[model samples]
Target: MNWRLVFVLFAVFAVGTNALIMAGIVPAIATGLNTSEAIAGLGLTVFALTYAVVGPTLPIILSRFGRRTIMAGGLILFIGGTVLSGLAPDVSIFMLSRVIVGVAAAAIPPQAAAIAIAISPPGREGRALGLLSAGILLSIALGVPLGSLLGIWLGYSGAFLFLASLGIVGLIGLFFIPPTPKPAKATIAEQFAPFRRPAVLVLGLCAFLFAWCQYSITTFFAPLVKDSAGISDVEVPILLVIYGLTGVVAALFGGRLIDRFSGYAVAIGGFIAITITTPLFSVASSFLIAAIVVVVWSLAQNVTFPAAQVEMGRLHPANPATAFALFAALVQAGGAIGAAVSAGVLEALGPRWIAPVAAVATLIGTIVISLLARRLRRQNEAQSILVEATVDEAS
Candidate 1:
């Protein structure tokens, strides 16, 4: 492993932990802010919406700077926003703080991925990307559960402070990393040129759909488990730990599988597994059954993300940064929409409906990926036939 990638992974872990920790402590935040959990959930929506809107543009706007400079700047902003979140007097101020953190977070993951790809040893790009994914998974496995415990013990404000401390650690670690080369300046249109491809469009849509499905449940995971299994607040973190640990295993090994098989194969399998297991949430009558379902669901969800990222790199090798930025933005947008939609569902129909709705989205995403795979296969076959005919004629 390149030591630099380790720092990149650490940076991602810090940022991702902040991004995901809210899901685990929504009730705490609601109680602290004197707002409804549904309103408190809007914090995620605001953050994700800001991230989706700002992420792709930030890289293009700052294309002149080295990757390290941009990432370090982001971490600085993250720390400030995290502290502000901890001090906010009301839900409105807390949400505004989230927007700041979202913009800050927008700077990290895509650049981290570009750095990983640039620095990784040959044929190990998948593993390298997997490591990046693991950073986020490990954040879930470790950070969220810990944050929830802190929220329980200290308050949601304390949880935010804990995350801010992590941000400071990530910022200091950034200085140790060797600076990455500056990207060439490109016009906005040129930067977005990859969107012209049909495959890129299809893949982006698939990313959105799957993310929509996944976040609908994940944004309210603690509440969902509580409602279904009658688990206490403290036990919610245990389930999250279980879910995230399984995700870490899947992400680390799923990269090797991507290298061995194709990204398309792995991604399709993941989507299918999710579609199957997601609806099972409706029937999870006991904590044990919910835990079992969570393991399968997390494995499917985690593997799908990295595989899609691998495909994004392959699909737009000429400018993977743009592809990654766009993918990240769409995923955030999907998450925002999903969270908002699920909040409405939770308010209207209740928690049980969330899984069925999410499953439908996953099923649609599965069909989208399958279609793209078939198209790519035919294109490869046609090119192979053309090469064979040219050789025969020459002979």
Candidate 2:
């Protein structure tokens, strides 16, 4: 494990922490801004939507720049936006600050992953990406709950301040990371060309649908548990910690399985399990059942994330950055759509329906992924034959 890879992991984790903090502390933010919880939740939608809409395009625009330039500048913007979020006096200002943070956060992860993969030792790409994925699980496990506790003690603004400090630390670490140049061989048209492939498009859709399932409930996880199960604010962190711990285990193992098996297999299996387990959450009326459901949900969801990245890397081995960028964008889009739609559903149907809806979404995703994987196999077989025939002719 190179120290620079550690820096990249931390950089990604720093941004990821803020995104998940809404899950644990939406009530605090709502109260601080004197807004409704639904409106406060919209802050997440804003951040996610901005990240989704703007993030993928950024890789293209910034492709001309070095990773050092892109990461350093994005960190500065991310840190500044986080500070602004801490100081925001109203919901409007808070949401605006989140947008800034969202766009800034969007630029860091794919570039960091690209650099990490480039420097990764041979046959260790899965392990390296696993570490990167672990950063995300750690943020959800440690950072979000801790931020919630901080909000309980210091105020919601204090939570933002803490997140800002982490961003600043990541910025400092950015300086120590070596520069990586963009792939000179990928033409601009080819950068977008992968989108036309059924395999890439389907995998991206899987990323989208999976994210939708996770974030739909997660954006409001704490409040829902409190309302439905009567869990106190003090117990919120514990529940989230359980979710995070389970997720960490799943992510680490999922990485190895993705290396041993194919990402297609892991994703299909995980998605089917997700479809089954997600609806179980709707029926979890007791704390113990809810906890179990949460753990299962987290495990199912977290395991597929790295697999999706691995699948995307396989889709375009020569341009992992581009592949990861598209995957990240779709994931963010799914999150944004999930959060936004769930906000409406929360107003109409309440939290209990969140998991059931997620189940339906994942069911759809499972079907599509299965079909896409079959198509990908056939395409690869045909290409193999073409290559063999070409070789035979030459001989």
lDDT of each: 0.85, 0.81
How many collisions per candidate? 0, 0
lDDT of 2 by residue, 1-395 (tens): 77777777777888998887776688888888889999998887799778888877777777777767887888888988988887889988999999999889888888777777777776666667777888888888887667768888878888888877777777788778766656666567877787787788888988889888888877778767776677777776788889888887887677778778887788888898899988776666778887988888888877778877877877876666677888999987887788778888888998877778777778989999899888879988999999999999999
State residue 171's C-alpha deviation in candidate 1, in Å. 2.9
Worst 10 residues of 1 by lDDT: 178-187
| TM-score for each candidate, following the candidate numbering | 0.87, 0.87
lDDT (C-alpha) at residue 13 in model 2: 84
Give per-residue CA lDDT, model 1, range 23-122, as digits (tens).
Answer: 7689988888899999998887788788888887787777777777878888889989999988899988999999999998898888788778877776
